[model samples]
Target: DPPNAHIEVSDDGQGIADQRVDGRYGLAIMAERAERIRGRLEIRPRHPHGTTVAVVLGPAGRRDSV
Candidate 1:
């Protein structure tokens, strides 16, 4: 809606706290890519389980939704 788009993924594992979480380049790379396309990336821990990764890009691309 509103010329915006959202992409999301989630898991049911132990989440970010239990993992080493440091010296990891995956998330960094993802975030950089998002910024390059004028988007935002988010990471959040699930209440009872894993993690959620989301990307939102908006106001600058094709608005048609299929």
Candidate 2:
């Protein structure tokens, strides 16, 4: 089996929208950093409220492994 690593953060405040996120440079920077490390960055609204931010990577030291 391969090594898997992920970091997740959740908030209880109002969720963010795509339109609102467009003006936020921090999110873009985070997404770019994740891509450079072969990781996936996800930002989505949580159930009913709040938001979730996650960075998931597969296979340690394996950048090509998605």
Candidate 3:
């Protein structure tokens, strides 16, 4: 991974009504996945429409030789 990796997933549909409380299983799953990989998940509304899901991740961990 690079110094800072930004994974942005956006759609041109209806955006998230509220950022704090979302009762969607998909969103929950995404959050879990991000956390599991030591990343940050952010869900926000687009400038015009739809939703924007951004996942910010740090560089990958170093692996030691066996």
lDDT against the true structure, each candidate: 0.80, 0.80, 0.74
For model 2, residues 1-66, the per-residue Cα lDDT tens digits are 453887899999988865755466988888888888877799989888999999888775355543
Model 1 segments more than 4 A misplaced: 1-3, 18-22, 61-66
Stretches off by above 4 angstroms in model 2 are: 1-3, 20-23, 60-66
Question: Scored by Cα lDDT, where does model 1 land?
Answer: 0.80
> Considering lDDT, which of the candidate structures 1 and 3 is the better prediction for this target?
1
Instruction: Tell me which residue pairs clash in candidate 2.
Output: none
Per-model TM-score, in order, reads 0.75, 0.75, 0.68
What does candidate 3's lDDT look like per residue over 1-66, in tens digits? 463667898999977766457465888888877777777789888878998898877777222221
Candidate 3: segments with Cα more than 4 A from true spot: 1-3, 19-23, 59-66
TM-score of 3: 0.68
Residues 1-66, model 1: lDDT tens digits = 563788999999888764556788888898988887878799999879899999888888544442
